[model samples]
Target: MLRRRGRLPAAPWLVAVTLSALLLAAARPAVGAAAWCIARSGASEKALQSALDYACGPAGGADCAPIQASGLCYLPNTLAAHASYAFNSIFQRSRAAPGACDFAGTATVTLTDPSQLWIMHLPFISKHCRAIRNTRLSILHSELHV
Candidate 1:
């Protein structure tokens, strides 16, 4: 009887595949961020003040949304939207807004649809929304309101 040649086992391939898979999984980009639904709404002028008042339960509130650029990360989407709207209630007014401020101060954004909205900086976003509003308003003021 002719002796059969001994074939090498394929264990290495299995290990390689498993390791590759793990590495691939680890390398996945911030994909979940796409799942977020973004929407915003502007609050009344000084909405922060109003919210504080409401939260305070009839104390006249704190007089502001209680947030800054760095603080945007702490605010929820809904809260941020309101604050943004309030800060920059006027679209045309925002168009002429200055740069590098806490919130944009003229636009309102809506963050909705997905409850688990993955925001990088909640406060920053809110601020930007306001800024956008301010910019738009400024433009309007220059173009029409003026």
Candidate 2:
């Protein structure tokens, strides 16, 4: 292969990829402004249950009715799902206070929208999906106005 004096074949695509990655990174919210809280993966179900209880209880005071039987988010019916919902609820309620997302290390804060994750995984035509869509829209509206 003969090298051109002033041109590199790979340089153009490399530059384009670098710029695309940078733009995507810049479009996301800052690390310090994580907007959702969820149960950390690898966290024990027991710990999640405890955190869920605390969040829905008086101390954490998260609105947890949505995870109740027949409630909008009741499907999935797993510890992690319910805990994530409760964690995010309290986190949002407290305006993302310094320690609000800790949950004794069982929870983590992230910029990703947890509701959107749920919506994507569930069947699009399911009743649960519609409920979550409505809920997510309302949450987004509140966030925008705030």
Candidate 3:
């Protein structure tokens, strides 16, 4: 080991490296803390519909094509289902920015996998699961692998 009589030259570099590491860690999501946004359970249908409209509207700019009449996610045909999808879409598009999932308090964030929970709630999952469109599933699969 080499010792310097005066101040060490590496002090600045060490500080910079420490700061860079802290910044990168702060920018990243917490380990094993996968998060998703969903419509709040027990919210009135009217409220859910309103939030859904906002989520699908220009203000929210969420991809709502999946919830249309002929869309893959239309089967459930419930306000909660539609709202959940819309809320999550906008939440994700916003990169989960603060208040992105609020929807006037009709929406919330969850650590649970909302997509899986939604699928489980579908009545026809056992019989018609294959018939449902897999666009979202495929996208999720791609993302997980990446």
Candidate 4:
């Protein structure tokens, strides 16, 4: 009997295995960008920071206290006016999967110079609710590939 030759001779399995790995390796983000988040909220960057701390995690201790009548609960007193219009780069929690960053809860934002920048001014409230609609704050995600 003559030697048999299959229509597909070489192994297609090897080709598939190689491609999957290359795709996954390239999918990860840079070490630096992956380390932390660059958040922009309120006018001063500090306000957003305080908000992150208030999340009540051990990682950032000072932020773990009960909201105080003194303005510690939300943006501080000095920053109130500008708070509605400011978005400063703050916290960093991976937004893709197991890690994520989001507004503490339902927030309300009002646009100050709605005409100029069209950027809204965020407001402080005791509680966050879904019915609330804010112009300044929003949920956004960048689909940039690694």
TM-score to true structure, per model: 0.22, 0.60, 0.61, 0.27
**Candidate 4 lowest-lDDT run of ten:** 81-90
Model 2 / residue 86 / CA error / Å: 0.4
What is candidate 4's TM-score against the reference? Answer: 0.27
Compute the lDDT for candidate 2. Answer: 0.76
RMSD of each: 14.2, 9.6, 10.3, 16.0
| lDDT by residue for model 1 (1-146), tens | 45446733467668888999999986543433221211134434464445433432433232233343433232544454434333332222334233311232323233232233445344333455456557877888899955
> How does model 3 score by TM-score?
0.61
Q: What is the clash tally of candidate 2?
A: 0
Best by lDDT: 2
State the lDDT at 64 in candidate 2: 80
Error of 1 at 142 (Å): 1.5
The sequence of per-residue lDDT tens digits that candidate 3 reaches over residues 101-122 is 7888898887666545755343
Candidate 2, after superposition: displacement of residue 36 in Å? 0.4
Name the 10 consecutive residues with the lowest summed lDDT in model 3: 122-131
Query: Could you give candidate 4's per-residue lDDT for residues 1-146 as a string of tens digits?
Result: 34357534346657777899889866665444432222333434565545454443354332222233332234333343222212211232223232333434212322222223222222232222112323112422223332
> In model 4, what is the error at residue 21, expressed in angstroms?
0.7
Off by over 4 Å in 2: 1-34, 116-146
Error of 3 at 116 (Å): 3.7
Give the winner by TM-score: 1 or 3.
Answer: 3
Best by TM-score, which number?
3
Q: What lDDT score is found at residue 45 in candidate 3?
A: 86
Worst 10-residue lDDT window for candidate 1 reads 31-40
